[model samples]
Target: MVKPATAADGRWDADPLLGLVAGCYVAAAVAPPVVFAGDAGLSLAAGGLYGLLLGTVLAVTAVVWVAVARARSLVVRLGRSRARWLLAVAPVGYALGGFALLGQTGIAGVLAFFAGLGAALLGIALAAMAHTRYVAATVDEASVEWDGRTGWPERARRRWRRGAWVVIGVTAVGFAVGVLTDRWWLRVAAQALFAGGVGFAQTGQERRYVCTEAGVEQRLPVARRLFGWATFDGYTRTDEAFVLHRPWRTDLRFAVADIDDPEVLADVLRRHLD
Candidate 1:
């Protein structure tokens, strides 16, 4: 559950401006795409009209976004902001599924697929920023303690790290096979394998933190593990980043790099300590 920040808690990951932009995205996704193909016949003029209509809709969406951001609470505002991106991503999935069902495979299909992919990627980037703000605000630096108990699940997770390397090794083999075979299906499978391998490799690193934060917790596999918990003191807010802090914790900064609501995290830490 996310912790709620009181008025006293420092604002973290709060982006009223971004929230407005995100709201516009949500509106755009919900609105109908301009329809140029009709009984009147599709022409350059019709296409131009379609574009003009779409642009107008987008402009209206922007206005609505601003209104919504101004009206909602910070947490609600952030949630709506993220929802906008998620809404934007839905179209990509729809396009992919539709094209696959239509048996459309070729340069055109690939181009269309990639176009959707690009939009999806952009949405993901926005969502990631929102997520960072959310986590930073909700998870306090102090709450993440290194007591001494190593639970069974944690041990199991640690043991699973061994499999991560194996997965990576297998992925490499698949990639080689796919390239040699020159089969389209094989190529896709190989890429999937490689991606999965990378995922597992990262998971293996995460396991390092699973070793209960007891005395001398295990260090990350290498010095370059970038996603470890930072002391609250290390966190800072920027115009681009979500900033959260608590007035009571003067010694620590407890800022999360890219959360949507740092206030929630601060509140969580505060309650846990109290």
Candidate 2:
């Protein structure tokens, strides 16, 4: 039986369940095309079957992860469980339309397209998981620091380079595939999904970052191939920081910090401007 979380425990106790659900959703989102790839015809029955399988996997994985978290004392079980019904209901989530797409392709082509879609979804799901892990680690550790050196610059540079590589690689592969197959539609679809995933992942990474002791030096692609730094404007007394421009192309409130060396950091930022 699921237990209720105590007042003292609050929302934090339920985080593990949320994580489990997220993981399952990711799995459900990615699995159908994988299974349908083996066969070329799609039907409602086939989709339902896949949905059931995917949902069960997600529910089971969630349960197991929760159990592990409990074992490790990472989360305390609430006497009242909100997720019990979710386990039972989640299996049908995949049926919402994974197999339905097959109808658009006339069963046979549906089978092929579904296969492609599922494959693409699988890649996206994996990327989501990786991103979640990174975010969770950063939040839990509170380890992000602005060491006020060239570290921020170097890291930013790397991030920009990595993003560029992803965009370029995906585009290049899509172009090559298009050329070889002479199928503009297939190439376009493939590149759309692949390149879009790369863009999303890189963007997410850029959104959450800290400037290490290294100088702030990252290049970002804008409307053109322009690159720039995460310029700092100054700081407010309330521990809020101001930067002339948002780094990583994200809009965020200032990062709050009460460092021992605000003056030096300010000077460094000013120097970069000059």
What total of clashing residue pairs does each candidate reach? 24, 19
Tell me the lDDT of model 2 at 132. Answer: 37
Residues 1-274 of candidate 1: C-alpha lDDT, one tens digit per residue: 3456555333322345555545544433433223222212343364565565467557765665555444334533453343746644675774475357444333334433544555465455445544454544444455454322111233334555567667767767777787887766666666667776666544422222211111113233321111323323233434333222334542222223333454654444443333
Candidate 2: list runs displaced more than 4 Å: 1-13, 16-274
Locate the minimum summed-lDDT window of 10 residues in model 2. 219-228
Cα deviation of 244, candidate 2, in Å: 19
- Model 1 vs. true fold: TM: 0.42
Q: What Cα-based lDDT does every candidate model obtain?
A: 0.44, 0.43
Largest TM-score belongs to which candidate?
1
Worst 10 residues of 1 by lDDT: 207-216
